[model samples]
Target: MIQNSKLFIAAAATLVAAVVLNPTPEQHRARIKEAIAERSPLAGFLGVGALTAFASTYHPLGLASYTTVNDHTVSIGVLGMVFVLQPSKDT
Candidate 1:
């Protein structure tokens, strides 16, 4: 438990530092997709919902997220915390 806490702290700190220095979502193509997706209100709405589900770690919304470290994958958000997302399967 203590080791998991430490890893979570370290990962959170690193994620925050990286974002502060480069405050953008993890992917370049995401920006493009966001631009395209937001053009329609439905897409924007679902995008917001998906983001909320991702943040809240709610499965009913069908939004799943994970990250990989040293070839090991770990959950992020209402599950476990470590690593940033690799890439979205869609877009």
Candidate 2:
């Protein structure tokens, strides 16, 4: 679990660095699309992770915390879906 967290941090850092380097507009769009695709699974994993972490911290109410995390995750996922489907400026 610790290892997974480290990996997620590394991946996010790399992504931030790549974006900060500032590719061309087309490259940026492509990168965004690729990133959204690649990180989709991570997003779900993060939701689960958050739930687990919450469980560890709060103890007794873990199930309810997990459900809340899941709900938030779904909302975020839906928002991302909307973002991905929106027409690009280049289009």
Candidate 3:
């Protein structure tokens, strides 16, 4: 558990550093997509699908909060999955 926590912290720090370096929009998108792809494609798909489903369930007024929360969850899942899967450089 301690090792896992340290690993998570390290990964989060690396991601933060990468973003702070102000990568181009395309680079950001590609990095994020690559991370997501590193995880099981199905997992990434499901994460986004779940967020969309949640957003769809709510009315417009209620949707903002739902979308915000769901988006954060999905993003974290994608990032974590990417870190865990550790895709190859070519990927």
Candidate 4:
């Protein structure tokens, strides 16, 4: 039981670190591509099949945020606190 708790803690910590890193848009795109190439479930978890110019809103209690906009935009909610990935100016 103690070992299991330790393993769970380690997994949670790793996830928190990954989320906090907040991959760049390019990196996010690459991640999606790689996931697809490897046929990983993470592909769908990343987001839409492909990212294109689009508008999205993040509700106060939203779990995740995603958008492809021209100007820089940012939104954070309750669970969003876990994964804070703000949209930057699309170049």
Candidate 5:
């Protein structure tokens, strides 16, 4: 429990850093794809195309995004905190 929470917090911090540094979805995807490539070549190759497909709306200090490759997940970030969710396939 505590260990899992720590890992989750670390992941969230890393994700926030990535988002902050890579403000655009394309840049963020590329960074993630590179990381994936480092671990698995095949998935990285496949990621090239899927990761390219994303729609985003950004505000002066925040962003809202929809990514197909992430199981149709929608993500929103404000004040450095990010939230993500996958809607039902039926929708």
Candidate 6:
């Protein structure tokens, strides 16, 4: 329960920060393109497929806060693993 609360808080903070920063549309598109461009062809295909499957799971929940919190944890876990595996550019 505590961990889930922490994840929710962190996500809230991130959303607040984004709103405060108000990134330009071009900046947002550039960032999105950079992210998509980094993925291999096979990985990108599977990622889109998996995301579609995940979206299909949302019908029952219908945009509940708890469901969002659960999804955030999955994203946080994936990002945690990626950060752990990747070395810092300054190294």
Task: Highest TM-score: give the candidate number.
Answer: 5
Task: Write down the RMSD of candidate 4 (Cα, Å).
Answer: 11.7
Which digits, one per residue and each the tens of the lDDT, describe model 5 over residues 1-91?
Answer: 9999999999998768655653455544444445545556886677742353333333333333433443443444344434443336687
lDDT of each: 0.40, 0.36, 0.39, 0.42, 0.49, 0.35
TM-score of 2: 0.26
Tens digit per residue, CA lDDT, model 2, 1-91 = 9999999999987666544543332332333344444557674445643343243221112112111122222111211121113224653
Q: After superposition, how far is residue 65 of candidate 5 from its true place, in Å?
A: 5.6
Badly placed stretches (over 4 Å) of model 5 are: 1-22, 45-91
* Model 1 regions more than 4 Å off: 23-91
| Number of the predicted model whose lDDT against the real structure is largest | 5
Q: Point out where model 6 deviates above 4 Å.
A: 24-91
Which one wins by lDDT: 1 or 6?
1
Q: Is candidate 2 or candidate 3 better by lDDT?
A: 3
Q: Give the TM-score of candidate 5.
A: 0.31
Clash pairs (backbone) in predicted model 5? none
44 Cα displacement, candidate 6 (Å): 36
Runs in model 4 deviating more than 4 A are 26-91
Model with the higher TM-score, candidate 1 or 5: 5
Model 1, global lDDT = 0.40
Candidate 4 lDDT over 3-88, as tens digits, reads 99999999987767655554444443444334443554564456543442123332221223333334443322222232234334
Residue lDDT tens for model 1, 1-91: 9999999999998766554444122332243335434555786666752453234321111123433334433233222222234334653
